[model samples]
Target: MNFIKTPTLLKNKSLSLLITARVSSNFAYQMLTVAIGWQMYSLTHSAFYLGLIGLVQFLPMLVLSLFVGHISDRYDRRKIVSISQLVQGICIALLAFGNYNGWITKESFLIMVFFIALAHSFEGPPMQALLPNIVERKIFPKASALVSSASQFAVIVGPGFAGILYSFGASLIYSITAGLLILASVLIIQIHVNKEERKPDPVNLKSFFAGITFIKSRPIILGAISLDLFAVLFGGATALLPIYASSILKIGSFGLGVLRSAPAVGALLMSALLTRKPLKRNVGKIMFTAVVCFGLSTIIFAISKSVIVSFLALFVLGASDVISVVIRSTLVQLETPDNMRGRVSSVNMIFIGTSNQLGEFESGITASLLGTVPAALLGGVGTILVVLIWRKLFSSLFTVDSFEGSKN
Candidate 1:
């Protein structure tokens, strides 16, 4: 997974390779989740199972967070990532085979989902850590935005495409997902990092918690990371999209795909703009404001019965989220030393995974008890409250004005 350094053009090629690798894998999973959500909800007719799916995915990330950082920093991160994709592909192939044979049940499906999450738990941090290695520091913010663009673009297409393909059967969806994941593995193998020496310290208990310690010590980094963690923790309504598609908007699987892809559409557009012109001023204020916008969009989405209005709200939501993501990612990578980036990234991943997967569980339970619309509205309002509180708590983050800050 590690290769010799080459020219600047090769660096760009490596960057492209990284983005393609990311896009392929991300696209595959986006499709996988779309199909899985539809299948699970169809079989059970329960939103709780959807939350269970989130819980299954989340337990692994929470359990594995301690060790993943040490492994990423100490081993070949690219190999780790490629191997993770390989495992996921194999699991998807098993899913396809099982579905074809007519033995896949909800219980069995969740078991498979756990393994997929297990593989993904190893994948996330290493993948995040890989970006800084590809491009020079000066160009990293632009490259980071480009990497986000690839992810967003994948999200934009994969679900909508999955909805179209889903008419054939779950087996077809699973088969295609497996193939794309394998392609991602292949692409990851081709990426060559710059000659950044990976100086891994010997593994110990201390190393496991180092990432957390590192984050807690840096206020700007801490502020950025925690802001995303809590904001999205309350704001995310991803786990409930299936319910919305089927019951609320009455939009079937294709409409579900459209609703799912809507945010990514906005995110892709925003990321493209950022790639062209990275944020130059008021970085902290911009991120906080973006979170507030995200909350407002969620509220709009929760209340809207009209398909067009919901999609538009989601579009605005995606655009707002990318702003927070790009700023937080840039700050985390730019400030951390290379040796600690993986550990730091692992901690960051835990927060991200928690905010998303755990948030899914939160949405699911809330939806089950309070009804979907109320649950979603609560999330939107909670997100805004979190932002207001975080601003007071993390005052250091609000005054910061640029990406060119003190590097640790």
Candidate 2:
């Protein structure tokens, strides 16, 4: 269990392959997200349509995350991930085709998004489950950090590059993204995971219910995951960035790229900061403070009209958010037993993924109903409230000893 002693994960050829594949896929996916938002907004000039795009992506993830988590635990994670990537590649190619043919309609593009979400529903849980097996458990923290950092780095690179390509045209961006997916799938074929054999759970309604039941039984994990869900669901402002770029900030696609990349920059920097010396004592307290700061930054961001001020706010928000991410991921990995990492990660995905995609949808809907400023401001307020409520309701689970003391 002293997995840190082994430098194998960092030095292992297979691990290197997996990391490369993940990074490439993530870069393309991040590019696609910003490209889609810009495309939709340019086509319709409405926040509701923006919300609809989020909804299209979120609905499948919400509906299928649990089942996919179960499948990941029960079957071949490598195959699952590879197949999902293949499907996603096809979906992106179709979008590219439509764009090239000048036959793209909003409804048709949204349907493509729906298929992409479906592929993601299967893709995420299995990919996360595959990680613990690829590296030793002791190295899990660093591995997770590297993975998170790699993905965020993609965010930094992808949208920034995409904005420039987007100027050339949406079709070009789609073509590039599709090419990345194909490359990712090829890389996945080179990596391997040792699948755990388990007896199939009963194929019935009870099995589905059991997944939720197991999650409810773990208060620390449940509390941490739920607190994040509520806090993020209410406060995430990513969905409204398009509006901010065009109308409020009076900036173009380049400004939009900077705005989108801001959080990833903060997160990447924090990840590097933590790697120098990992988070030790009072992790729970740190996580709480981070969430509070995330809310505060969002509030500040909502009120800021200046691009420079908003970027600063986003940086803080990203920094705070990554603190919580590292803590929460560590907590889940430490607390969950080995037999159930996939299921647990899948369950975790339900909270985390939904909070992100659905949170985007919520922001979009609220922005459509209320004005964008009010919508964002209200989310910030709600995030603060969630933190306070979680502190009270789950007080006991939110504290941690210093890393040295706990390790003993």
Q: Across residues 1-408, which tens digit of lDDT does each residue of candidate 1 receive?
A: 112123452458888788788889879988998999999999898888998888899999989976887888888889988999999999999999999999999999999999989988988888888988888888778878878887888999999999998888989999999999999999997888875776787777777788998888898899888888888888878789999999989999999899999999999999988877889899989999999999999999999999999999999999999999999999998898888888999899989988998989889898899999998999999999999998999888987888896343
Candidate number achieving the greatest lDDT relative to the actual structure:
1
Each model's RMSD to truth, in Å? 3.4, 3.0
| C-alpha TM-score for every candidate | 0.96, 0.94
Winning candidate number (TM-score)? 1
**What lDDT tens digits, residue by residue, belong to model 2 across residues 102-209?**
988888878888998889788877787677677776666677777677678887888789888898889999999988988888888778665455665766766655
Score candidate 1 by lDDT.
0.88
lDDT (0-100) at residue 365 of candidate 2? 89
Model 2 lDDT at residue 97? 88
Off by over 4 Å in 2: 1-7, 194-199, 402-408
Off by over 4 Å in 1: 1-11, 406-408
What are the Cα lDDT values of the candidates?
0.88, 0.82
Clash list (residue pairs), candidate 2: none
